[model samples]
Target: DTVSYGRIFKADKQTRIASVGIGYADGVPRALSNRLIVKINNKKYHQIGRICMDQLMIEINDENPIAIGDEVILIDPNESKDLTLEDWAKLTNTITDEIICQFTTRLKRIEI
Candidate 1:
């Protein structure tokens, strides 16, 4: 089945598409739709299709043990340098501070 608002992603076979609880409205760029890769359980998965206002979708294999409450990391500097704000800024052709500031209050901020 196709996924997201524009149906931009279609799996080659039957696959699980997990809807992450954050998206454009949460400061995730729409331009990062197909370009973003999120980490879950130390495994990276591509953010597929056109990003929605409140959520995005990721393709998951049937073999993956990901569950509803599993943590999905959008930008984890410690995990992978590639997942940092600087990388996202480069991908979106913007400054890191701009990217950082774009995130809305809808998302919960946790200081580590």
Candidate 2:
């Protein structure tokens, strides 16, 4: 998070929130909220506010680490500081399976 975000949230701009044309919608609990912080090219961004059933918003800083359609990590299981679905489970007070199953048919699997 940075000062630009603090400023932009106050103003609400389409240019400010980093988002995907696609995201979760299948019964995703809003309590996951801003807990999912994605890492891209070594920079971090918090998914803004509550995650909608069909979409989620992420903040991109002036120190942009990604471009449109660039690959990024939603949560890394191997990294020392990686965030996991378990984190979402904790935030939402739910089981890990539910968090993991949130992905829709829209997601393409990558064997990491």
Among the numbered candidates, top TM-score falls to: 1
Per the 3 Å backbone cut-off, how many clashing residue pairs does candidate 2 have?
1
RMSD of each: 1.4, 5.2
Report the Cα lDDT for residue 64, model 2: 61
Estimate, for each residue in 1-112, the C-alpha lDDT of model 2 and write its tens digit. 3322223234244446666444556544566556667777777777765566566677775656567877667667765543676766777788889877776766677796
Residue ranges of candidate 2 with Cα displaced over 4 Å = 1-15, 26-28
What is the alpha-carbon RMSD of candidate 1 to the true structure?
Answer: 1.4
Model 1 TM:
0.91
Angstrom error at residue 87, model 2: 1.1
Tens digit of per-residue lDDT, candidate 1, span 20-79: 999899999998889998999888898889999999998887576999899999998786
Q: For model 2, what is the C-alpha lDDT against the true structure?
A: 0.63
What lDDT does candidate 2 reach at residue 74?
A: 68
Off by over 4 Å in 1: none
**TM-scores of all models?**
0.91, 0.69
